[model samples]
Each structure stands twice: as structure tokens, then as C-alpha cells.
Target: MGCCVSTSSRSTCSTRSHGGAVSPSCFEVGFCGQKRTKRTFSDHVIALQHLPSVPNRIFTNGKSRTSCIFTQQGRKGINQDAMIVWEDFMSEDVTFCGVFDGHGPHGHLVARKVRDALPLKLLSSMHSYQSRQNGSGRTCFRGNSKKSDGGDSEKDGSAEDRLNSIWKEAFMKSYKAMDKELRSHPNLDCFCSGSTAVTIVKQGSNLFMGYIGDSRAIMGSKDSNDSMVAIQLTVDLKPDLPREAERIKRCKGRVFALQDEPEVPRVWLPFDDAPGLAMARAFGDFCLKEYGVISIPEFSHRILTERDQFIVLASDGVWDVLSNEEVVEIVSSAPTRSSAAGILVDSAAREWKLKYPTSKMDDCAVVCLFLDGKMDSESDYEEQGFSSATLQSNHSGNAVESDDGQKSEPSLQRNFTVRSSEESDSYGRLPPEFEGNADTVAAEDQNWLGLEGVTRVNSLVQLPRFSEERPNP
Candidate 1:
């Protein structure tokens, strides 16, 4: 009465041993010793005699498969990061999710780099410098705890200072590595490649966040009706600010380098005036390395007590389509992280569908991390399929009233979950030495930013004429 689901013990692997376990498909297998039956779900299940302990493809719902490739070779003609990984053993608390939407060809590489290294960088930097005795040549965080005026030091420290120590070191190291990789192996797809980083670190009940570039981190929960508290952390590192514009005029607007284009994301006029950023600030664009691409990340701490709502981390794609508060309401209403991720991606895609109308599809990737929740049953993913994305014509998106005639807009439409795709198990297609490392890792020599940064594809995408070929904002 059980199908033997082979377990490779890898996060992406989904084998089936029918001991009250379920696969999306069903198949029958027969053996020589005794008549045996194995139920397969989707295309993942197969029946044969003397089968090896491992199967190339594991059981998957078949809605979608994890390509893990950021190159055009892996792009599935749509912009969606809809992954249903770790079918059963996903961690209930402290879920880490991120979205890397690249403005140019290098987007894919940027996305993969952050997913693999960003967290490790943050935690590692925090502990490394804080350690009193470390042989690594990095600076020890020994700032004066003295008071400004000869008075007794009342302020031992602010949370920002402690957090900034880590933020500064981690960002410095990560950006330097990212920039080095980008410069060495330039992705022709985008002459200027940069991405927004939004990280959600929920340690215990304490919620901490840090971001660079315009990728936003918005908060959502039911404390204040359907509205979400959009506390923006990172500022656009663009040189086009009014103050920057004025500074440029004063300096007679000195000659700009290939990287000094103020039109870049975080690049300000008069070059060294403000935090030097071409596309403002980012994790991996090495072109702006000379300008100290190291971005001072906005840091904050919030105890995720009863009043907090679901958290969202998305690329500029979602933000470009929806407002910050609008996103909060949408995800807050979402029952699960998977659905929330799906809804964000799909909704963004729909918006592109309307704007481009006649053009081909655009890429959109979204990931929503539901804070501290439990998924005890399958219905958690909705009964039939899942939540979906649709065209929203009438969006008075600017902070409206709720149906009780209350002024808050309910972010999610009730009873909405569109079932899209599921990951396909690798039972046969994998090489003998096949490990799931490549999906989440790059080759040792490929570490463009200390992790084998891959400048795989560099196709010049089409855009409106007279506009910047590579879109950074």
C-alpha cells in the first residue's frame, strides 16, 4: 500500500516510498522476488525490475521544474521564481527568501550570487570582526564609546551601530567580491549589470533587515487593517538627485568616466560628492568599484511580536508594478509563503502583459517569506491548485478605503490561489556524479564575487529607442 520513494536526502530531491506518502502521480512497479507495486506521481514515477536505489527524476507535481539556470538556456520565457522545493521537510520557522531582478544580462548571475553568498557574508562578517582574536587582516570594530561633550556616556550604543558594524563589513566584502567578478568577466547582455538586494533575517522573534539599491523591504500584518507599513530601508544611489545635480553645476560638472555616468543608479554628480554609486549602490557591479561601490545598507530591528504581519522580499519588477503598501496588503492576505510568492510574481507579470500588450513576455521573479508559521496539512496550499495572477484594470492603488467603508484597502482578493507549476524530480537525467550543487552554486573558478560568479549569457535585450540599452532603475 506504499510506493517506495527513493530519498537522495537533497533539498531538491523528491523520491517516493509509499508508506502513507504521496506523489503527484501514480504508477505500478513489479519485482521478481514478490509482486510489488509503487505508485508514481506525475512523470517522476517509473516501474522496472532491479531498479537502482536512485532515480533520475523524482516525483513532481509537474507544474514547473527547477532549471536553476540564469542564462537564456534556463529562462522559461517567463519571469517567475515559482519553486516548490523540499516537498515535506521545509523549515517551519526562520524561512530565508530573496529576489534578484537584474536590469541587464547580468541579472541572473546577480540573483544566484546573492541567494548563495549574501547571508553567509552577513553572518560571517558579524562574527569575524567581532571576534577579538582573528588572524584575518580585516579591521576590528573598535569605535570610541565616549560621549560627545565630556558628560557621562549615557548611550552605550544604538542598535544601528552594532548592526552597522556587520552591515558595513559584510557589504564591503560582498560588494568588493561582486565588483571584482563583474569587471573580470563582463556580461555582454548588460554592459552595466546591477541588482537590488532585500534580505529578511528573522532570528527567533526578532526581525532584522538590510538592503542596498531600490529593491524594497515592506512589512505586512493585520495590526492596522489591510494597510502594510512600508518602512523603506535603502535609498536610490542615483547621481541624479537635486542636491547632486546642484553639486555637479558647482564643480562645472567634471568629465565622467564610462562608469561615472550620473544616469547610473546610485551615481551622483560631482562624482565623489555622495556615496559613490553609478547605479547608486549594489552587491556585485564591479564597474563602479573605483567609486567605492560599497553601499551603506539601511539597517533596523523589529521584534516580530503579535502585531507583525507576513513579510515580502521582491525585485524592482514587483515594486515597478505595485505600490509598497499595495504589496503589503496582498501578501498579508495570502495564507502561505508559496502562494504569496506566486501571487507577487503573477501579479507583476499581468501588469507587464497590459503595458506591453503586443510585445513578447517579460521576466519576473518573486519570493515571499511567511514569518514564523506552521503548515500542518496539504490544504495549506489551497484545495484544488493555487493562487493566480490576473489583470487588475481598476487599481486606485493609492491608499484607499476598505469595504466596511473603512479607509483601508484589503490587499488580497478572497479565495485566490492559482496552481502554476511543480518541480520535477531528478530520477534519471542526472549524471552519476550528479549533486544538486550546481543549482545553488557556481564552479570554484566561476566565483565572480568569491563564489565563482558566472557571466554566462550577454544578449542585448530590446527596449524603446533612444533609451538606455541596459535598464538599471
Candidate 2:
């Protein structure tokens, strides 16, 4: 059963909620139409729900079964936490792509915030892109699954450079905007809430990447024989990497496990907890702010290819289980983009489910894109022989179905909007968050200063963000 827990300080939208701390008049809770609480102002800190937090468990051979809490009510959980195969995302302009992974709770809500935020950010960024393009007369361009490197044929003009400038604006602006939107929502406090984001912006022949988290981006191309090859263009925010591990220890953050692991091998969450979240680097997680969360910027504009066969975008749900090569194989063999996403999620989710029956099934979110084989060829859309052109998808259900054909437990998920020709939304709403949680604060704030070797790219320009036109704020 799914339950939603929210403490609305004000009553406006009517959605079910529970286990929240709200004032007698402004707050209310209802389960299946039964009013559990009524007329109360919400407390500053409250659990959207009182769901159990068991150890992250996954059954062997099960796919990505990350634990998730769904309010199962109305829009209350619409964005609360969920995952979908995103079977179809047909587009005419630069393929729209994104990856949003939430933490500290089910990813559905964070994902929703991201889904809403990205389009807004992109729309907001259009003004910036347009201004830059108008001023310089540069060519325009643009995911996770979107290739980082297009063929040399695609990498022609100032498109890559302009793309970088625009996206930088989008991410920084959206981060702040998201904070504001969440705060103003009916029931939500400044709880360390947020999600990791990685997206792509493509135009004409150019491709750009925008990211702020550990989620990765890759490019793949197939040979005439129909075999796919992939290349990774993103690096992880590993806290225990040789260089990073030492920095955490120096800053007084726990670099190793608390279970008496060896010093050199020991590691803890960049903020708190153990088991899974050890990333010294990631986005969102208001709790990690004190540790210089805002200081960490995204890595952008690695590369894109026309020879690029396909692109893959996924939450850690996919990475948590499949190897890079394994992921490539699944996507390469899949009949369609939607099938690719479903196959990947279904496989990953089951692994987690079987391994962690006592734990929450990791919700899997995948957005995959395949090249228009006919685009490279002089064939018309009709000649491309797209069996499902008018249809939004060409997915194969069994790609993710069980042996018995029974569907897995319903996880949280939501629809997303794609922004094109530059989305020009406004900016600056969220205050850079503070207040690290007890379990993770010490590590997150660990100030391992004066690290050698690794150079911090504070103001580096990459695709999707940054441009010479706008003055740095």
C-alpha cells in the first residue's frame, strides 16, 4: 500500500496526506477519504509519511528495486517518488533528454520538481541563448542518452560553444528556482530535499550536455552489421577516490566505514549514512549544503557524435547493477527506445527486489534515444520505415515482463516536458540550503582543504551552461 505524508502550512490543493506536523487549522490528513487530521498549521519539520526505512536490500538476480514511498493519493505523490520506462519521447527538434534521481526519499517528487524545473529552466535559458546568438550570430544546438559527441559532421560551428553557455545558465538558475518552488508548495519544509540532474540539448547537428550529479552520459554508434559501441563522457563524484578520500579525511569527515574498516580503505557518506551513498560528489540533498554543496558545479560538454548510434540516461538505478558494457548490450539489442528503457529498468529493478525483499524496490527511470537511421540516409520519414511513427513508442512489453507475465509492484513515476529553442524561465528562488542532517553532516562539511593534484574547475565552461555574453553573477 502507498501513503503520502505532507504538512501543508496552508490549504489550497486537496490531496491526501498523513504523519505530518501542521497547525490545527492549516493542516489536514486523510486516508482514503477519511480525515485523519484537520484544520492545522504545519510544523517546520515533518515526514511526508511514516514509512519504514529498512536496510537497502535487493534479491539476487532482481533488477533495480530501490526502496520508494508513494503517497498513492493524488498529485501528492505524483511527484513524490516513482519511476517509469518513459517508453516514448518523440520529438522533432534536438532530442529532449534528462535524468533526475532524488535522494533521502522516493525519487518521484524530486523527479517531478526536476521535470517541472528543467523545462522552466530551459525556457528561462532561451532568453540567454537568444541574446547570445543574436549578439554573436552563432549557430544553435543541445541529454543523458543523447550522445556527447556527434560525428565530425555534426561538430561544425559555434553551436557547441553557445550550447555550453545557455545550459550553465539553466542549471544554476534552476537549482535556485527549484528550492523556491518546493518551499511554496502546499506541504513541504526545507527538509534536505533535492535530486541529481543530467540532461542534453541538441539543435541542428550539435549536441550539448548539462549535468549536476553522478548520473552519467554516453555515446554509442552501430556498425553496418548492426552492432552498437558506446563511449563514456562523464566522471563520477567518488568520495573515496585516492585523491578525494584523503581530502575527506583531512577535513575531518569520516573517509572509511564506521565498522572499523582500515584507514586507507575506510569511507563514509559524503554527508551521512553508509551502505550505498558514498559519493563524495552529487547534486541536491539540501543536507549536504554545509559541506560546500553549492561550490560543486557540473561537468559539461564532453562530446557528441553523428556516428553516435544511441544515447542512454538513467538514475543510479541502472548503474547500481549493470556494468557499462552490459548496459550497452541491452540498449543496442532493444528494438526501440522505449523498449530499451523498459528492458533496462525491468532488469535492474528485479535485481534490487529479489536482493532486498525487506528493503524498498529501487525505482528505475530510464530515457533512451536512438538515432533516426534514415536521417543519415536520404530516405524520407516514410522510407525510414518507422513501424510506429505516428505512435509515441515502438516498445516491446516482454522486454521487461516477468516469466509469469505478472507486473512488478507499481513504483512512482511522472511525465516530463521537453524544452526547445531555448526555454526562458526566470531565476533565483531557493536560498543555498543549510542544516546538515545528524547522520551525514560531519562528513559533508569535512573541509579537506589544500588538496594536491586535483584541480577544481570553478567557472569552467561546458555545453548547456556558460557563455562569454553574460557576465557571471
Candidate 3:
């Protein structure tokens, strides 16, 4: 007999197997079997509550028949990283890929929200821009480009250049609209939470990219001597960058490194030292928007060549422990095209444990897009092993001593804590949540800042007060 369960709002039931498990026939295999059938009443309710209004064509799992994508949760808490790969995105030959790394209390939700909504926004903007061009009967880029002197000069550039211009405009519009929507979201509290995005669109031989934050993208190509070489495609938008730091300081936001972790620079408010965000650009984080933190993505274009093999988009988790050369070598040596991303992620996880035995691992996400439609033979490079020299110079900055006098680097998984006015006396004491065995804490409440198991110092040196508003005695 079928079992029935009822709640205050509704009722549900289904045939159960002899072992009390959900019937296998009722399950629908999602892309790469990434999604499983709901087995309980609460699971079904949660799925129904979060269903998207519009269907998505993007694949989030590495097991997809069409593309490669994978993500692993860290020891700290729920995975705050997300990724997507969409084939035939806007046209028969175009493709879209992105990776996001989230931070703060609601970071995981923010990352997934951007993964589902950002691509749709880009598609809509592209359609609207095309409509405007069709009506005006002009080939200019929204009146931003200089007018040609005469003749066919306006259409003289190569096809690649024209494609880049159109995509650049679409990316700008979509990113701005996405950030605006996040700010007004009724269910999300984005005052201190945010995410970083590294996205790319490949139309035929041209590749256009728009990104914000520390997540990165890189390309692997064969050199004249048949050796695979790594080419970094995006610059990490950290607060330490000269231009990024200047803008924040101009808006009265303070930028500096803590005495304990001197290698990592962070951005803080003028009156309070809370929310020491490491990245200079990100979605949400409404608190810092007024202090020069912007969502405008840095854009770039690359024309693919016969030598280019594949492109990898990943969050800082992967980049933190692995260098560009090491990542490229690992992907190139994968046993099969479908297993490339998974192998790389597993390798990173192993490295985290080996390098920082005492620190909690960070969430890792990766997307591997092959260009030649086939996997190359394994190279003759030595077995997977990390050199001490490479670890000291990973992308963000050089290595520094931790509070316990151990070597460490700035991790993208750093924590963001906001203290209330009444909690000033408990500044140096560890929160009760982290008092016992660290691994025993709930995933949602795990702290990313104290990964090395060290006590945190209060970031705020002095509190601000208003003198003129005092009551007359």
C-alpha cells in the first residue's frame, strides 16, 4: 500500500519499496545524475519552494553528457561556490561558462542565485540590443564609438573586433541589471554578503570575457616545441591592486592588512572595521557600494588559435593551492575528457590537506571546456606533486607567518564577522560556537576566518560617537 504524509498546508504520498526507500521508477535522472529524487516530505517541500520560474539549459554537474563541471564542499561549511556550462547558449555555435565564489552568512544562496539569473539577463540584453540596431539601421555600438569620416571605414574592422564590441555592451548591461536585482530581492539580505563572477562567451573563434572578484580563467595552449603552456586570462580584483585601493580610499573606505596576516589586504568602513572584504568588486555587498565598491566587470577578448587547447574557469579555492602551470598539467594529463574537471578538483582537495594540515579546506569549483573536440595524450610531466617554491607565490600574494608562527597565504574563504554594539567586551574571546571541537560545529555556522584555529583580534580600534546630539544636562 502507498504511504501518505500530511502537513498543515498540504499532503503527499508515493509507493515505497520493501526497504522503505523511494521507488527508483519515480526518479528522474538530471544532467550527469547530479540531482536525486526526493525521498522525504521535507526534501520535497524544499525542492518545490526553490523551483525556478524559467527552465535552465545550463549544466551544473561534471557528469553531463555535453560538458564538464564540478564542485566540492569544504570543511568550513556549506559550499559557497557555483558553476555552469551552457552549450548553444544564444546560437548554434556559441557557448557560455561561469564560476562564482561567495562569502558571508548567505553566500551559498547568493552564488546559486547568480548562476541561475545572470545568464538569462545577458541573453535578454543581447536580444534588446539587436532590436535597437535593427530599428536604427546603423552598425554603431549604442552611440559610444566615434563616427567614421566617410566611405566603408565604419565597417572596416575585422569580424572579430565587431563581435567583441557587441558582446562588451551586452555584458555591461547584464551585470548592472543583475546587481540591481540582488539589492531589491525581498528574501535575501545582501548588506554584508556577496559573490564573485568570472564569465565567458565563445562565439565561433572569438572569446569575450567579463569578470569581477578573485575567481579566475586561464587558457592552455601548445608551444612550438609541443609543450603545454599556461596563459592567465583575467586579473584578480583584490583590494591590494593599486587602482582598486585608490578608488576605495578616495571614497573614505579604509584599506589595510591586519598585523597577524600581513600578506592579505582588506577593505573596511570609515567608522567601523567590520566586514573586511578582500575583493574590490563583487555582486551585492550593498554596504560597500557607497564606499567605491562597484559591480562593473573588467572585459577582455581573445581570438582562438589552432594551438589553443582548452580553457578552465574556477573559483579561488582551486587557484589558492594550485599554480597555473600545475593546473594546466593536471588537466592535460587526465585519462579522459569527461573526467578532467573531477580529477583536477580531487587533486586540489588533496593538496589542501597536504599544505595546510591544521587549517580547514576551502570550497573548490571548476569548469573545463575543450576547444579541439578531443582530449590530448598524457604529457611526459612528472607525477602530481607541488613544490614548496610554487606554494609561496600562489596568485594572491606571497606567503606569511600565521598567528602560530606557521607559514600561510591569504585564502579567498576568509570570514566576514559583524559585531553588535553590546558585544564590545567579548572582543578577544572565541565565540561559543567555536569553543569546542571545530569540526563538530554545524556546517552553516562554521567560521572561515579562524581556519588555522587561532583566536581573532577585534578589527575595530575605536568606536565613533556624535558630540552635538548629546542631551542638554
Best by lDDT: 3
List where candidate 1 sits over 4 angstroms from the true fold.
Answer: 1-96, 130-164, 181-191, 223-233, 236-239, 242-278, 288-296, 335-337, 355-362, 382-473
RMSD of each: 19.7, 19.5, 17.7
Residue-pair clashes per candidate = 57, 93, 0
Q: How does each model score on lDDT? A: 0.36, 0.39, 0.61
| Candidate 2 regions with alpha-carbon error over 4 angstroms | 1-92, 129-163, 179-186, 223-227, 241-255, 260-277, 281-283, 295-297, 350-360, 373-473
Error of 1 at 363 (Å): 2.6
| Ranking of candidates on lDDT, top first | 3, 2, 1
Q: TM-score for each prediction?
A: 0.49, 0.51, 0.67
Residue 186, candidate 2: how far off, in angstroms?
Answer: 6.5
> How well is each residue in 49-153 modelled by candidate 2, as lDDT tens digits?
221111111111111111111111111122232222211111122334566665444344555555534443444444444445546854323211233356743
Q: Distance from true position, residue 63, model 2, in Å?
A: 21
lDDT of prediction 1: 0.36
